[model samples]
Target: MSEPDPGLSSGAVVAEPETLHAPPPRLSSPLARLALDFCASRPAVAGLAVILVVAVAAIFAPLIVPQNPYDLAQLDIMDGTLPPGSPSYAFGTYWLGTDVQGRDMLSAIVYGLRISLLVGSVSVAFALVIGSAVGLVAAFFGGGLDSLLMRIVDIQLSFPAILVALILLAIFGNGVDKVIIALVIVQWAYYARAVRGSALVERRKEYIDAAVCLGLGTRRVLFGHLLPNCLPPLIVIATVQVAHAVALEATLSFLGVGVPITEPSLGLLIANGFEYMMSGRYWISFFPGVALVVVIVAINLVGDRLRDLLNPRLQR
Candidate 1:
């Protein structure tokens, strides 16, 4: 053994070897953390990419697609039902072909996606607002009012969402606004139940008691104090519900009780092509069906990943 340095004090202690550990990467904000979490999963990233592509196509359909599927003046009846890759006299190459009305399949699919997303998003927003309000009021009060509200939710929940939507549509007649209203009525019950559950737990927390003790109004106590804490699960539900609303709207449209003929959706496009499937005109329905599946699957992937990311138990 080597002798210790003579200059060192008897009570002095030598330092241990330093371990070479890298510092954690800095996350600038909550959004940055969410972005990192989202990118950590390859499937979620791919789903997001697909959603972005479809959304972009839908948003810029008129600029990108060669023909305007919705414009009567742009269509030529002679070109109707052209097969994929067929040559069009008016628009050069019809890459995805034309429908029965001589509308380009690609353009129609993009426009249909636009309509589906629009209805889905708007209905979800309306449902969230209506449901959250009902849930907050019920949970915050916790009395006969809660019992009455909950019984209504229970009755609505007993029926299938599609069945309820169909019944409402039957009574209201078919149109975009009517379809949205039907979807909201069908979906609000779900959000109401979810929000009420979350609010029930949150209402007992210290912050909620403090807010109440501060003489905050009922609106402030429910909306401001309780609602924010209950939002994580609501966000996850909203993402999944939007996909549900889209599929439900498509089903209603396919059954001839959804959007009007003037405003076509993927469901309507598929329905239009159903009669010709026995012939060789498969591309009409096939392409639209694929688009619908892709949109639904992509949204589901994102929603599932969000559920995992947001849930603490799942994180463990």
Candidate 2:
């Protein structure tokens, strides 16, 4: 009794070694890892490489372009329709040829890409924020508001995106900002629909219930707990929508209601060359058209990759 039982002694009792689970091997960021994974697929890597090259070229347009295509003063009507690699061109030789205005085809493509990227990026961003907000609110607070919003979304969806843009442009007049606004109006519904669907699921989760029970405000619950979970889908949607938006912008500009003649977008360039396309002056429209296709295809490739990576259901 004075010595104490051996089993009860602290020295006699052996403790189990603490097992530290190695933090689940750090997975690279969704985008970074996905980009790395793209190398596994030739097509994905090709698409990614195309985007990077185009981006770099677009960014360095000022340095690389022989002259600003937009500067009307520098253009020569004689240079117009000069075939690609034509020695007859005023600059001695031209790659991708020139439009009716003799603006460098390569330069125009670069400049047009920049504008397309800008308008597409901005419009999608605007739409994302507004749509996410509307969707979250509708999901968080249903009834009349939900009905009204969802019905509006349905109505908008009934019409084509192009039709919506055309109508809005007609009412507002043509310009980059106007096109962006129209796109946001037309596209917001899709985002809203997506976000609302996500929010509906998230709102029903036990965490949301716990948050509500803890006296968390609607703002905190809606944004803090719910929004982050909803982003992967939204991000993938946004990436694809960028291609859609760029195409739309090009369409608007081609229709003479976008960016204006002075600031030619890819659509406008294509339109400008359309007249000469059959006349053997194909490069004018052909190159820009190819650029647009490439941009859209590349973006879709990346978007598809992102969807596969982020979506558990899609993982093979």
C-alpha RMSD values across all candidates = 4.0, 7.9
Off by over 4 Å in 1: 1-22
> lDDT scores for all predictions?
0.91, 0.87
| TM-scores, each model vs. reference | 0.92, 0.87
Q: Model 2: runs farther than 4 Å from truth?
A: 1-39, 88-92
Candidate 1 lDDT tens digits, 115-142:
8999999999999999999999999998
TM-score of 1: 0.92
Please write out the lDDT profile of model 2 over residues 198-302, one tens digit for every residue.
999998999989999999999999899999989989989999999999999998898898888878589998998898767888888889999999999998998
